[model samples]
Target: MALTNSKPKIAIVYASATGHTERLTEMIVDASVSQGLQPEIFPVKEFDLKELLRYDIVVVGTYTWMNGEIPRQLHSLFEAIEQQSGDLVTGVFGTGDRCFATYCGAVDLFRDMLHAKTQLAATLKVEQMPSAEDRLRCDAFMNSVWRKYSQHVENLVAAKP
Candidate 1:
């Protein structure tokens, strides 16, 4: 559903093959709540491109595959967000094995395009599932997003008169 509210909407959309990315998504969701921001979590397959207009912030998570290709399920969302989310703040995160040459390469792929398209608040790369040490990074990512959203709102208000 399209959102129309004073509360800034955030969506954590992701693709997870082995559940590692999902674990990261949960951390992001919890972080958003702790920031006093309600967020919607969607699998990349279930996300609607048009729903992007409803959000002020968008976070994407993925697991890197062999080399660094974006998962097939996320390719379309990857392209669509750049086209639609220019005014929105965005963050990208992923989980991957550091043993690989391109650790969390999928995060890099998304990060490049998001920087070109959205406000690209923060990008995080976590090796596999998040551990206690990663909690600080997750909180920082969420804080960055909240700061961008707040600044955007302030700018809007200032511009109005």
Candidate 2:
């Protein structure tokens, strides 16, 4: 049988207390679809490890809470990713208040974990209540990261001689 190449599947998962992170996830989903890729959105609280591993690319979103730590639900997911042996390509984004001591706290946590664990593709940070420019920058960042990741995957597939 002849094999056909297909577009990669992308998943956007988020944990939000005040909806900021969820909104960002929705934006990523929309952008991914607009770029002619398969994409889905999931709340991190309801995300499953098996489902996450199925995606070729995963975008994680979170809102800062308490200090600069990830929420309990997402911590579990991060732990799972850390323990797994699979190479999960990931992008990260978050929303937080700049007035706080740490701006984009959730994003900070993601950077730390990604540095220690998975191969982090990119990270975008937005204000808690993002401005028009912030939104534009976030969208642009997503586009650039997605394109880079796509190229990386293509190279990997082509190099499998």
In candidate 2, where is summed lDDT lowest over 10 consecutive residues?
A: 1-10
Those runs of model 1 whose alpha carbons end farther than 4 Å from true positions after fitting are 1-5
Question: Which candidate number maximizes lDDT?
Answer: 1
Q: Model 2's lDDT to the true fold?
A: 0.72
The most accurate candidate by TM-score is: 1
| Candidate 1 clash pair list | none
- Local accuracy of candidate 1 as per-residue lDDT tens digits, 40-90: 999988899887787778899999988987899998888778787467889
How many clashing residue pairs are found in candidate 1? 0
TM-score (C-alpha, index-matched) for candidate 2 = 0.84
For candidate 2, write residues 11-112 as lDDT tens digits: 788888887777777677666766677777788766778776676677788888777777877887777777744355678888888788878877877777
Q: How does model 1 fare in lDDT? A: 0.85
